[model samples]
Target chain A: AQTVTQSQPEMSVQEAETVTLSCTYDTSESNYYLFWYKQPPSRQMILVIRQEAYKQQNATENRFSVNFQKAAKSFSLKISDSQLGDTAMYFCAFMTHVGGSARQLTFGSGTQLTVLP
Target chain B: GAGVSQSPSNKVTEKGKDVELRCDPISGHTALYWYRQRLGQGLEFLIYFQGNSAPDKSGLPSDRFSAERTGESVSTLTIQRTQQEDSAVYLCASSLNRGSLNTGELFFGEGSRLTVL
Candidate 1:
């Protein structure tokens, strides 16, 4: 099986600043996927970004970017120019194909980020 | 709605009782997943459904938890003899395809909060 770990249980960042949340995982599979999800107070889980194992380049989406160190098995999320809307519970997830088109995700404990004003 | 839909945004049930949570995936989505989020914890994969293949039940914590998806649309997660440990938010997600495929993006619902007391 696979396991994802988020050492930070909580984090706070001032608005317009930058913040990085740490994540690590244990997996033996060579090909897989990584994802970051955000759950706001409304309880909706939203996909923030994704990274593919085969790619050496980290994934980025606007202010959301990832520093993926394959050798260290580390995938951290960097949020730049943070906004109050970024305050949420962030999760790091791992996935690998199970069958033809089936896959399962293993997720970390999560980091509650509060973007302070 | 254009997004995945989950019912009973909030459900409070007594211990040992049975509770069912519903999810309606976005139209045309071929894959669906269920995850559990306990208080102050990361998401735990419960089950996954893709196309007409057998659903993956490996992630289920126990036999007390079972889920069924009708075709490619609606899914229901049933917890029998619920325990206090079952008190958590149940999240549902749907994807165009599994990870490593098309988008590999899972669109999530707001989630159903279950409180077993």
Candidate 2:
């Protein structure tokens, strides 16, 4: 079984500043995928960024990027120049590269991020 | 619609009552997924369906929770005798193909919020 852990329950960042949310996972499988999802007040789950375990380079999407350390089993999300719209609950999820024939995801508890003006 | 659609955006039912949630995946998507998000918490995988194959119901919390997908399109999640603990947002997602290595992005719906009193 794979388990994702987000040690921080709550985080706050000043507007226009940068913030990093930490995530760690336990998985015996060598091939896998790591994802960060955001849930806003509208209750919609949106994909933030994703990293492939085999990729040595981190994944970056505009202001959102991931620091993926496969050896350490760590995948952290970084949000640059945070805006008020970035305030949301962030979750880290793990999936098997083999596909959902296994049909499941292991998610962390979540970290509530508040972007203060 | 361009994105996945979930019906009955909000549902409130008394304990022990049965509730049914519906999901309509993207037109050409062949894989659908169901997940639960408790308030102030992360997502919990529930079930998954790919094309016309038997669904992977491994993530369902209990036997009381069951889901079905028909014609590789619409899906419904049914909870029998719901408990107060069932209160949460139910999310649905879909992807083009599950077997492909490029299946990284998942389109999500606004989610159906279930309130069990």
Candidate 3:
């Protein structure tokens, strides 16, 4: 079994500033995928970014980027030029192949991010 | 639909009552997932469906929770004799299954919030 951890329960950032949410996971498998998802007040879970275990380069999507440290088992999300729209609960997830064809995602506890104006 | 859709965005029911939540995955998606998100908590995997394969019920918390997917399209999650602990946001997601290695990023629905009183 795999588990993900988010040390921060809540975070706040000012508009136009940058903030980073930390995530770590415990997995014995060498091949896997990591993801960050954002859920807003409207209850929609939106994909933020993704990182593959074999890839050395991190993933970046516009203002959202990730610092994936494979050896240390850390994958943190960085939000730049934060806006009010970024205020939401962010979750880090870990996925790996199971039973040949099954794929399961294990998620960490979320971090509530509030981007203040 | 252009995106994953979940019905009964908000459901309020008393304890001991049965509740059903529906999910319609993205067109052509071969994989569908169910997750539970309690208030101020992270997402927890509930079940998974891939094509016509037997669904993965390993993540289900108990026998009270059950889910079914017809073909590769709509899915319904049912909670029998729900408890107060059953009150949470039920999220549905879908993704393209490329192979055993890459399941691709999941696209999520707005989720169905169940409030048990």
Off by over 4 Å in 2: A99-103
Model 2, B1-117: lDDT tens per residue? Answer: 788999999999999999999999999888789999887778888887888564577789999998888898999999999999999999999877646535566778999999999
What's chain A's TM-score in each predicted model?
0.96, 0.95, 0.95
lDDT tens digits, residue span A21-85, model 3: 99999999988889999989998888899987989999999999999999999999999999999
Which residue pairs collide, candidate 3?
Answer: none
> Number of clashes in every candidate structure?
0, 1, 0
- Cα lDDT tens digits, model 1, B10-116, are 99999999999999999998989999988778888888888645368788898999888887789999999999989999999988884445466789998999999
* Candidates in order: C-alpha RMSD to true structure: 1.7, 1.7, 1.8
What is the DockQ ranking, best to worst?
3, 1, 2
Query: What DockQ does each listed candidate score?
Result: 0.64, 0.58, 0.64
Off by over 4 Å in 3: A98-102, B100-103
Contacts from the true interface found in each model, as a fraction, amount to 0.73, 0.59, 0.69
Return the lDDT, model 1, position A84: 97
Distance from true location, Cα of A40 in model 3, Å: 1.0
TM-score of chain A of 1: 0.96
Evaluate residue B111 in candidate 2 and report its C-alpha lDDT on the 0 to 100 scale: 96
